[model samples]
Target: MTKKRKKEKFYVEEGETVADCLNRMAANGYQPVRRMEEPVLKEVKKNGKVDVEVSHQRIMFEGKLKEE
Candidate 1:
């Protein structure tokens, strides 16, 4: 019988590279199942108008525990 897969999300911290995060996950016996990225937007008001600006990008990694 196969066990249910478990998933978790991880973020890339400041001064930390994506590779570092992935390695950390692997060390915990998890493998990356999916990769995601999104933009962090901020609202700016100028000239009686509002605009959305991308302040930074968010990197996310979804991992599933390996069944050993």
Candidate 2:
């Protein structure tokens, strides 16, 4: 039997830089391995509101890591 690895998530606050935040997390026992290497379905607009002109887009912001 094989053990399944659980996916981890780290939601950052608005106006937070992903790279900076990830680095901080890494120093504190959370080692960030890789970020979005593939495509994903996501929605983007001027803001939180989705735009009809450009519907959901393929995006990837996944930063894999293990928390201590």
Candidate 3:
């Protein structure tokens, strides 16, 4: 049998709540060990100049495999 990863990263999908993401991790036999958020950057042109802005925050979780 293939070895399963001890740790994995999961992203909160669009339209999904944080609780929903946790539930998903539990369903996959993993427990969340850490939560993180990072800004999503986007570029916009204004008056022939490009400006970078934070579009949104991306939520992610670090999961560890549950011990049986």
- How far out, in Å, is residue 8 in model 3? 0.3
What number of clashing residue pairs does each candidate have, in the order they appear?
0, 0, 0
**Residue pair clashes in candidate 2:** none
Question: What overall lDDT, based on C-alpha atoms, would model 2 receive against the true structure?
Answer: 0.50
lDDT per residue as tens, model 3, 1-68: 78779999999999999999999999988999999999999999999999999999999999999999
| Model 2 agreement with the true structure over 1-68: per-residue lDDT tens digits | 65424444454445667776676666544555545433334555767787545333332244444643
lDDT against the true structure, each candidate: 0.89, 0.50, 0.97
Of models 1 and 3, which has the larger TM-score?
3
Check candidate 3 and list the clashing pairs.
none
Worst 10-residue lDDT window, candidate 1: 1-10
Instruction: Tell me each candidate's TM-score.
Output: 0.79, 0.35, 0.94
Angstrom error at residue 28, model 3 = 0.7
Give me candidate 2's TM-score against the actual structure: 0.35
